[model samples]
Target: MKKILTLVVLSFTLTMNAFAAQKLDVEVNGLVCDFCAQALEKVFGKKESVKEIDVNLTERYVRITLNEGKEIADEEVKKLIIDAGYDVVKINRVEE
Candidate 1:
């Protein structure tokens, strides 16, 4: 009975982790046009870890959804955005 209970708990934990998503909202500065948004999307979209990306020019924020069990470090995010000629104001991570 104890073994069965443990198994059930473990399975539930694994299932939850498998479905977990890592979302990152990066507030940026210096993104001026549609072209800039497209460039940002292309840069982040090339990463296998990134599942989806949304660029909001009005707010100057980039939203990135990471694939299951995948992540990009905060420093790397900052570096990439900077390399693309944008300033990183903040990186907010949401786990779901």
Candidate 2:
């Protein structure tokens, strides 16, 4: 019984850690120029929890990484990108 309990606790901790390191891939429209990309970066960069950001101009995708145990809502991220003078086509949470 003790062994089983230990395993259960370990499993829960691992699951929570996995969720904490979640990364999201957001695809946006009208990301045609450097200025527009810069704007998007600026908005997300301001977030304290954001760890890294990658922008693909050709694919019009923005990949964002949040610090461990940190996450920004989809709507909030989308709104930030939209406010930067572009349209958020879609936001998807990438699987690890």
Candidate 3:
């Protein structure tokens, strides 16, 4: 009975996490080179809340996937890009 309960709890936790994750597509300006992509990666990749990051220099966008039940506010996202010497064009919150 104890083992069954533990397994059921673990499964529930995993299911909740899978459904709670969020993705953000942040369009940025002034990303002219590979160095800029690297810079964005460095800044966003270190955060525990960020599960993954994809920087596209050509599209001038950064795709960030936040960990379960975690989020980065619009203001903070804009601030980070501005501080990195880039301009934030738009931020779209994508819920899955």
TM-score of each prediction: 0.87, 0.82, 0.77
Which scores higher on TM-score, 1 or 3? Answer: 1
Which 10 residues in a row give candidate 1 its minimum summed lDDT? Answer: 14-23
lDDT of 3 by residue, 1-96 (tens): 999999999999888867686999999989999899989889888888899999988787899999887878899889888988999999998877
Candidate 1 ranges beyond 4 A from true positions: none
Candidate 2, residues 1-96: lDDT per residue as tens digits? 999999999999888876776688888888888888788788889998798888999988999988877878998988888788888878888655
Candidate 2 at 65: error in angstroms?
0.7
In candidate 1, position 66 carries an lDDT of 96
Q: Model 3 segments beyond 4 Å from truth?
A: 1-18
lDDT of 1 by residue, 1-96 (tens): 999999999999999987799899999999889999988899998999999999999888999999988879999999889998999999999878
lDDT of 2 at 62: 93
> If ranked by TM-score, best first, what sequence of candidates would result?
1, 2, 3
The count of residue-pair clashes in candidate 3 stands at: 0
User: Candidate 2 deviates by what RMSD?
Assistant: 2.3
lDDT of 3: 0.89
Candidate 2 residue runs with Cα over 4 Å from true position: 2-20
C-alpha lDDT of candidate 1 relative to the true structure: 0.92
